[model samples]
Target chain A: MSTQAIIAIGVFLITYAFIVTEKIHRTIIAMAGGIMMVLLGIIGQEKALQHIDFNTLGLLTGMMIIVAITAETGLFKYIAIWAAKKVKGDPLKILVVLGIITALGSAFLDNVTTVLLMVPVTFSITRQLRVNPIPFLITEVIASNIGGTSTLIGDPPNIMLGSAVKELTFMAFINNLTAISFFILFVNIAILAFIYRKQLRTSAELMANLMDMDEKEEITDKTLLRKSLIALTVTILGFFLHQLLHIESATVALTGAFLLLLLTGEKYLDKAFLKVEWTTIFFFIGLFVLVSGLIETGVISKLADYSVHLTGGDVKSTAILILWVSAIASAFIDNIPFVATMIPMIKDMGELGVSNLEPLWWSLSLGACLGGNGTLIGASANVIVAGLAAKEGHSITFGKFLLIAFPLMILSIIICTVYIYFRYLI
Target chain B: MNVAYKYDEKLLELKETANGDDIEFLITLFDSELKKRLIKVREFFEDNKILTDIHYYIHPNNKYQIIVRKDFYNEFLIQLFRQELLQEIKWR
Candidate 1:
């Protein structure tokens, strides 16, 4: 390997190690690692800038703005209450319904935002129903990760995949992954509901009390809701038609965000911007430059070459290996940086003789996104929910989450193994 | 039955009920400005990291509902007084 390649590998590994240790903030580590690459002459500053995927950052920022404002409208709480009332206030039934709602919400919004909105409502509903909230919280956390697997914009990994490969369009993700993701969601929730069925029971009196809640009262601002719905609709529609419209996903998202700001006027501008997870955005920015060092150094190509040779240039074995490895690795470490590194490697695999890259892309997406359900620390959504629940005195400890979620994650991977084998590999 | 708080309707109306060990408060604000006070009380609870201690809901025309745990009832009342929603508060 060239000296630059060796230095790039060293920088990348040190950065990855720091991120895994969780002692320092991940954004700081990622940014520091990226700066090292530039300062060490592994990659040029201008070339590193070119490597930053603005599409991913723009989409994330835009969606964050939209969800932040929409959240203020009390729409999420309204929907949760409305769904609970629909299920006749049965705790078990409410658990399933909330899981489904979480999945749907995460499919449209980001997983962390979806779970953040769900946690408070979960606590409120469980408190009212007089049942334990841990099951419901755990279910939502898993569902959020699975739900985030279904779309291009749902999970950070998928977003990176969509932006890195033009062929994997918004519709492409919907067509391939959405159905399988929901199928996994159903399987996971069924098991959760069965396990927690005993804890889900509540007195008829409590049920009636929950029923008495006025969901209509939850709409804090109808005017804002209407405008938000309009912007959200246009933005989603833009995603559906973005490929046909020959525009990038980031443009659609930013346009939708700015349109909402226009309709809502300047009042929401600062709030929306404030609500954008700038730390996450910077993390992505740093990761791009860090990965560019490896790419520019030809290290990623060498790894791809080795991987292709190991799989004997076989598509099925390579796809399965990628899928399983991604799932297992993502369960322990952050998937964003993992996917960032994999994207270039996979692209290189294409040049190295992988005739069908379709299955490979889908495998990476499924494995990385759904793999988060394996443990409490697997994904940001899981960690956020655990922290919030612990703060509320309902601790979802690492061991407890692993005891339940790990087996289910394995089961999910088994199902994916079947789906990928049948749907794509065949 | 315990009176959670006594408030002038001009500022806000506090209706209380007991559900097991928890107290539910359905607050209606007559003056639009009192919404800020209610928000302050909500922020106080959130700032303390006591998420489940209260559930705050909003209704049209400046109406709000908050359910408080019995354990946090005293603290909740103190917040109302602090935010000036309650003109005065007394022990006993």
Candidate 2:
């Protein structure tokens, strides 16, 4: 390796170490590493800028704005309270109903936002029934991750993958992963029910208390809710027709955000824009530059060559290898950068005569998205839910979360492994 | 009758010149609202058929003294002064 190549690798490793340790803010770490890559001349400024995937950033920001406005209308709270009522305060029934809502919500809306809406109301319901909120929270986290696997806009990793591979469309992601995601979601519910069977029971009086709550009171702003919902529906339609319209997903998302801002009145523009997770966006930018350095140094191609060699150039073996490795690595590390780095390597493999790259992309998608359930820190949604729980005095320790999460995560991966094998590898 | 309320240290003091029946009604309203908003208090209300361990001082100076528990005090005040409830009671 050349001196510059060695420096690039060093910077990448150090940045990854910081990310994994999570002592410092990930955005800061990523930004510092990205700057180092440019300063070290591993990749020039323009090339680094080129590497940043604005499509993914744009989608995230736009969706965040929509969610922010929608949340302000108390729509998510309304859904949660409504789901709680539907179960009649039956703890297990509440689990299943809320789990499904979370899965579907995460699929359509992003996972973190879905959980942000679901968790507090979950806490409220569980507290009313005198049950531990851990099981429900854990199930929601897992469901969010699985549901996020099903669509281009569902999860950050999927968003990254979708933007990186132009051929991977909105419907393509839905068609490929939705069934598997639902399968995993059902398995998740079963496991949670069995594990918490003792805690998932409540009395008639508790049910009566819950029934008395006026769910309509949860809707803080009905007019804003209507406007936000319309904008969201239009945006989703835009995503579906983007291919036909020859428009980018980013443009579609930004249009929806701006339209909602206008419809909801220009006064909310500042609050809606502020709701965008700038830290996350900057983190993606920094990660792209660092990975771009690896690409510029030919490290990604060499790694792809190494992977090809290990699989003996067999497509099935390569797909399984990527799926399993991505699953395990994503459980510990942030999957965004992992997917970002793998995108180029997989592309390199395609150039190196890997006939079918579609299966590999699917494998990466399933593995990375589902693998987030393995640990508390594995995904942004997990950490946010955990923090919320702790603030409410129901702290979910890392060990406690992993005790259930790790086994369940492994089971989900196994299911994914089988599904990928049958659907693609054969 | 006029009613004045203030938070001092860990206590919520209410000075009411209302008749006993009216004061009783307000207390009931306060308890129900607390049960609705604060989960901890709701759990207590469910277990015991009354508000949990709520102590009050019946004196001229502190007409009603609520010994707000440290944990539930913040939520207690939040519920008592919530805009909608305040509007309903014409306190806002």
Candidate 3:
């Protein structure tokens, strides 16, 4: 390698390590790294912007607006309440309901938005019921990641992976991956339930003291919810309808959001969308450019070549390797960019004649998604959830999360490995 | 077998009025959706008047449940619960 290549490698490693440690905001680290590469002329400005996929950004923005509108309807709250009444303030019920919602939401949207909305409600429910919210919250963080791997629009990483492979369509993604995704989710739900069973069961006569103080605010305007629901439903249906009918995903999502604004009369729309974290968008864009620097300078290709050789070009071996590596990497670094980076590496493996690329992709997806459950900083959803929870004064310590999260994440990964390889490889 | 709906709406007459027991009322339901919203709405009560708790084996089916303890039913809460929100789904 040339001296410039050596310097580039060192810069990338240092940035990667700091991000895993989460000693600072990833946006700061990633954006700084991308700019450093540009200043050094490792890549030009135009090249970097090209690396920054506007489709991913646009898709995310449109989806966020839809979720924002959904939140206004208090549907999540309603669903949560209905679930609790069914299980009756049971911790396991909280986990199951939260888990299902997180996974489902992540499948349709992204984990960050899903968890952002779920965490407070999780905290509220658990706190009211006088139980630890850690387990249920942890499940949401885990399920959201795992479930997000199923579809193209579900997470940034999936989107990056699909577009990197020649802009794979929505149906192509779901058809290829959703079955494995459901299997992973199934195992996750079962294992997490077992882990939190004890703490979730502590009951006392004084329990009712923990209930939330306001039922009134949940009663938002009726017309708003109805209209929001209609718009949101149409958008989701439109996503699935793309193969049979010609509809752009972005146009559908944005139209729903805008229509929601018009339907609800903007009063509620402004309040909801204002909470959208635009900084996250910048972070994704910056990281794309930074990773592009690696690809441009040939680091990604070299790594991919080495990875294929290391696994002896066996799909089974590669799938297992990706699962373990991604799970660990995701536990520390943000999974979106990590998964995004892995997509190209996997394609490179495919070029080297790696069979069963589908299973290998699923392995990477499962690892990153479930692995994020292991650490507080592993996924944006976790960080956002933890941050939002802290703002509510409930301190979900990194240490505490690891205590519950690590085992669940590992077990889930293992389950994923068996299912994917057994079903897909042999 | 008539298993409890994973969720249920119970009109508790107070764990007390059964003959004035100091602990008031204890309302229980299986794990389901209302669990979260019910918890959110709990904050409206005066601190000591209501209580809630999370239990793992709230049911024999291995699912969880949310049980609320309240001195008495609050009408405002009823109206709020009944509010035609997007879809405030509850179980019987």
Candidate 4:
């Protein structure tokens, strides 16, 4: 191999190692690597930033703002109570409800936010019911990964994939629903069934005393509540309108978020914005630059050739290969960067001599999103869920998360592969 | 600015006094629509007997910051009220 290629390989491996050990925070390491890439002269600063995918960044930031606003509504805690009650002293039902709501929420919102909103509630409910929160929390981790796989804005990887190619519009995503949703859903449900059959049957009450917490909330001004409703209703309507008008999702989300800030006249607007997680944005920016280093150093073309050879020039074969590999690798390393690196590689697969691998894009998207379930580190969404749940003292250990997440991830990928081959590749 | 000066006496000092992780969540402009929507959610909580962890608010200054988790400061709410008083602000 060439010297530049060797050096690039070294950089990738080092990043990979740090990610796996996770002794060093991934965000810090990523930011440092992003800086290193620029200093090393591997890529120019502007070019590196260009790779950052502002659209994805904007979408995430916008949604986070919305979540920040909505989280205050007592919506999540209220649901937590509902889940605890519905389980009706049944541990299994609690597990199922956690999974279902997580999936649904992740579909509309990003997975990390969904998990962030749910985890604390999950912990408190489980703690009150005197049942282990581990299983229910883990199920949420899996469900978020699976459910977030389908939508363009649901997961970071999908957003990356969307920006990687402009032709892959928001509408195109919904149009391809058969592959993204139905395909992923069946596998998700199957995995949940296999893991929680016994838990579902158990009569262990996980949240018996949770109702008292719900009774204390006072609502004195009925009029103020009415105004807030108008803002929310208008926001949803704006989202659809923007989608049709081809306005970026980020713009729509940000508009909604800012509008709320104006309407409420909250004293803590800055605090809410501050809570938006700038670290996550920095991670994406740095990761984008780091991946650009690979491309600038001629590493992308080389890897593309290798990937094409591995699939033996068959599109179907390449799709399956990319899908499975992405799914597996993402479980161990964060999928956003992994998927980011693969986009150029796959784009090259078809850009040159590797014909018919066009469908590989969808494969990668499906793989990266679904792959998030295999390990806590696989997706940022998983890590946040794990971290947040742990903070709530529910103790979602890496080992336990993987124990549930891995099998479900594998099954979901298998299902995705089948659906893709029949619907697109075959 | 059309300053619509409105304040809930219960939280007049919210600008200075803050306590509990959830105290910030209680302050915002209820105006009619938001209150009704919140009532449905409250009823849902009431039916289930769940405790209120945070009070909801919609900031009129920046409409996107709906569901404010912080208490409404008097100064800020006055500015929002003044917004209606201001002729330039248009409500869709």
TM-score per model for chain B alone?
0.83, 0.30, 0.30, 0.29
Minimum summed lDDT over a 10-residue window in model 4 chain A is located at A203-212
Could you give candidate 2's per-residue lDDT for residues A289-363 as a string of tens digits? Answer: 999999999999999999888887788999988888898898899999899899999999999889999889999
The positional error of residue A48 in candidate 2, measured at the CA in angstroms, is 1.0
**lDDT by residue for model 4 (A1-426), tens:** 667666666776687678678888778888778787777776678888777778778877877776776666666665655665665645666677777788878876778888877776665554445456667777787778877876676788887876777667666665664246645665565666666666544323223323323322332434444444555566556554655677776676677777777776775387568778888888888788778888888889888988777767788888888889888988777887788789888878777677665478778888878887888778777777666555544567778777776877787787788878988886
| Clash numbers, per candidate | 0, 0, 53, 66
Candidates ranked by TM-score = 1, 2, 3, 4
Candidate 1 chain B lowest-lDDT run of ten: B1-10
Candidate 3 lDDT, A1-426, residue by residue in tens: 666677677777887877777788878888888788888888899998888877667677778877877776677766665566566556676688779878888999778778766765676566555577767777787788778888877777676665565436678678867887777677778877887788776464423332322333354557767887788788788777765676556666677777777777757666666756687877887788778878888888888899888878888888888889988987887787787678878877777788658877767766776687788887778887777667545678999888877877787777777787777788
List native contact recovery per candidate, as a fraction of 1.
0.46, 0.00, 0.00, 0.00
- The candidate that achieves the highest lDDT relative to the unseen native structure: 1
Candidate 4, residues B1-92, lDDT tens digits: the string is 22222345332212323333322323333344444444554344334322222233223321211121233333333333443321222332
DockQ, prediction 4: 0.03
Q: Per-model TM-score of chain A alone?
A: 0.99, 0.98, 0.86, 0.86
Model 4 CA deviation exceeding 4 Å by range: A1-6, A83-90, A177-243, A353-358, A387-397, B1-92
Expressed as tens digits, the lDDT of each residue in B49-69 for candidate 2 is 222222221212212223443
What's the residue-level lDDT of A7 in candidate 1?
94
Candidate 1 residue runs with Cα over 4 Å from true position: B1-22, B26-49, B57-65, B82-85, B88-92
Which clashing pairs does model 1 show? none
DockQ values of all predictions? 0.43, 0.06, 0.04, 0.03
Q: What is candidate 1's CA lDDT for residue A330?
A: 94
